[model samples]
Target: MLKNVLKSVGEYKKETILSPVTVALEVLLEVLIPYFMAVLIDKGINTGDMTEIIKYGMLLVVLAMAALAFGALSGHYAAVASAGFAKNLRKRMFYKVQDFSFLNIDHFSTSSLVTRMTTDITNVQNAYQMIIRVAVRAPIMLIMAFFMAFKVNSELATIYLWVIPILGIALAFIMTHVHPIFVRVFKTYDKLNNVVQENVHGIRVVKSFVREDFEEQKFKKISSSIYKDFTKAEKMIAFNAPVMQICVYTCMILISWIGANLIVGGTMTAGELTSMFTYTMQILMSLMMLSMIFVMTIMSKASVERINEVLIEVPDIANPEKPVTEVANGSIDFDHVSFSYSQNPEKLCLKDIDLHIKSGETIGIIGGTGSAKSSLVQLIPRLYDITSGTLKVGGRDVRDYDLEVLRDAVSMVLQKNVLFSGTIKENLRWGNPNATEEELIHACQLAQADDFIQTFPDQYDTYIEQGGSNVSGGQKQRICIARALLKKPAILILDDSTSAVDTKTDAMIQKAFIDEIPDTTRLIIAQRISSVQNADRIVVMDNGRITDVGTHEELLASSKIYQEVYYSQVKGAADNE
Candidate 1:
């Protein structure tokens, strides 16, 4: 986990190294101050030499200023290194998510990923700053201070050796017990974020159903879980401070008692006793800092594992070696293809099937909800790989071509129409970034979207709310269709994309496809029989299998499933009239 996380510290290596170097220098200067004060008190005051006092005091002032400079520099570098490391970590995770295939995304929830990038990264950042500064300073200060105390008088120095082990054992006990609780706490944080996200995104439906009370209850349950876990963990961590204070007081008293006896016996002077007291505080304070570092490291260990999970995950999809660069045409072939979202052969969503579509042909597909109509078309863009058999686009295996090149040649307007928060023109430009104004207007007209767009006060530049909530369902669908048309793909697919528009507009959109883009193959998946009656050929699917394929009239006479659907829709239309 440490190896994986350190990779994101790119370019900050200089600051990372410099922070500890300055901290060590600061510790060295601090250690020298106490020793110099011992010289000033013993040789200058006791022996009545004013020159010794003046010389050591000035030297002490210079050492203090240098220590201040080093401390400030270390703090500045630690801040820079930690914040930069966090920024790079977020950027790396987002780019990695972009590279993941649909299969990989299914393995992790949207809310879980958000929590890892945000709360988890912040914890790691705080811990890293502490590690570079306090973690470095503590040990160096402890060693240097202990060495000075022993040099002054070895008997008082032995006090620290006994007290250090007692403090160490107490800290180890606190750390081991609290770590598992922190792990549980962070996982609950993921659940809390997920609840908030779901409520916010589906607030409209929740309000319409009057489920605000229910949502509040659910949130409280998860939030309360986090509170309980945190309180328990903090209670365990709270043991640390009291234990540290007890050891500090015990060591100070022991050192004072021993030094007083030694001084009266004529072996130790008042100046040496004062220095021993100073070293005792420095050593104990350093031990306290180490305890704090250990506590932070335990908390951050959970965050580190969560972050490394994302950083180390291998993208499920990548371009093949020696990939084909071009797609010759829109012709597609599915040779005994089968697919399962779980990648398990026994639970395939699409059964072994064979279908071939020629360039420039208009094909209509009708099926029940689980018949895998959307699943079939999604394979063309390589959104998910087939589990078995060969799936080819432009007369070559889909896995053979570079993924970007293959996807660019195919445009699909899915069953769920999505529009981002931007001006109408900005969203349309997603299809073709460099599309001219005339081209944008032309594509909208073909999709039967130009009339409604013109009615908006800002026309093509009208602002769209997030998810296009400012527009009606039908208008959102039409705008999405226009965006796909702007791509001018070799193959155009409308997967129930016209369900919101009136029958007349749907017919007009279909007619525009025939009149304007004769050489581009079009695939229409719809539930309405009227939508597919004029196709060159229609496919009838049942239970993940294509039961029949023919022109509309041929299917009406020969395919039982087609006959049942066509009559039911016609009967519903008659009854409405």
Candidate 2:
């Protein structure tokens, strides 16, 4: 845990040390105040010197005011530094997540990462503050108070020093017990977060199914488990507080007992005995403050380790040592391509697939629910590398091309297209930032989105909520298509992107696309046969491999898989009519 804490600090070397140094000055004043109090009590009060009392009392006030000023300044700096560190850490983590290939993202879910960003980062900030604020102050006060006690009477201070080693042993025991509980507690917190996220996002589904009670029960089970784990960990560490307090109080009792004997024997004056008691109390109280920091450090160590896991993950697809890519036409060839997601099941997503798509031709990929259509498209853009075969984009192997170059040549409209919280023009501009008004209108026309967009209150200036939730499904799909069309790439992929639209709009969109982009190489993945019937070639896949390849008429005449899907869908459409 301590190692991880040091590592977390090591990453933010610039910001971490400055605040502590500023705070050290504030802590020095805290230590100085007690000595001033001692001087005022002994040098002024007992000796009956009015002039000395007023002078030292005024000095005490000045020191206290100075202490307050130091505290406010240091506190402002510390907060600024801590918040800036957290911001930098989160931004770095977010970029790291972006750089990490899909495999790393799959390993950590959306909710899990959210918990790491929000809850875990907060723990680190808290730990950082405690380490700066209390850790420095407590030890300095402890040392200064001890030295003062020994100056007044050496015997009483010795008794206080003896209890220190026992406090250290008790602390060691508490830390030993805290480590495991903290690990379990963090996991439990992630689980609880996931459950809450699911329940909230799918609250409508839960209500529709009338399973609110069921979902609530499930949440309660996880929540109760988290509650139990957290309480258990707190109690394990909480035992240290009472135990340390008892030891400190015992030392206090011993000091009062021993100091009185010295005073009676005329070895210690009354004022000297009083100063020793105050110093003993200061030492024990400082130890208690230090104990709180110890407890926080134990928990934060786990959080830092969790954060470090993300910071160090290197992406599989990074800059190549040497660059190589040259292609004019958009052509794709997959030779015996095979891939499986590294996670559970390990079922092959694409198996022994071989296909070629020519430039200036439209290819349709038709498949059932789990037939690897999306997986095949993902490989073309190299979102996930093909586990075992050769894939070439534009006559060159994709791996030979720089990642940016390959992605630039290809534009894909994913099935779940999300628009940011911005104006309609802003989302479209993401596809081609340099596009003029005429170019934007042309792309929107090709996408069959110009009609409805112009109907809106602000037209192009209309604001879209994040994920385009404010718009209808069909409108979002058309906008996504417009965004893709605006890119005007050498290769374009629409992965079941038109699923939400009515058949008429889908047909109109497809027609405009064919009219405007006839020479642009395209791959259309759709469930409906009518949508793909006009494609130059159609590929039919079953399970994970392509089972058929031909024109619409050729597939109806030849492949069993293709024939079955076509006739089933055609029959359903006719039955509905």
Computed on alpha carbons, the lDDT of every model, listed in order, comes to 0.91, 0.82
lDDT of 2 at 451: 91
* Candidate 2 lDDT by residue in tens digits, 1-577: 4343344443455545655665677767766676677778778998999988999899989888887887786677567667766777777788788777787787777777888899989998888777766687788778887787777778777887677888788788888888788888778788888889888867778999999889889889988887887888888788877877788778878877877887788887776766676777778888888888889988988888888877766676665677565556789999998988872236678888999999878999998899999999988877888788799988888888888778877889877888889999999999999999888888888888899999999999999996787898788988999998887788989998898888888898888877887767889999888889999999999899899999999999998888888889889988999
C-alpha RMSD for every candidate: 1.9, 2.4
Residues forming the 10-long window of minimal summed lDDT in candidate 2? 1-10
Q: Which sections of candidate 2 miss by over 4 Å?
A: 1-15, 325-327, 343-347
Residue-wise C-alpha lDDT for candidate 1, range 1-577, written one tens digit per residue = 8988888899999999999999999999999998989889998988889999899989999999999999999999999999999999999889998988888777777888899899989999999999999999999999999889999998889888988778878888988899999999888888899999999989999999999999999999999999998999888888888988898899888878888999999999999999888998899899999999999999999999988888888876789999999989888899999999888999998898899999999999999888999989988888999999999888999999898988888999976888999999999999999999999999999999999999999999999999898999889989999999988899999999989888999999999999999989899999988888899999988888899999999999999999999999889999999
Q: List the residue pairs that clash in candidate 1.
A: none
CA shift at 132, candidate 2, in angstroms?
A: 2.6
Question: What's the true lDDT of residue 366 in model 2?
Answer: 95
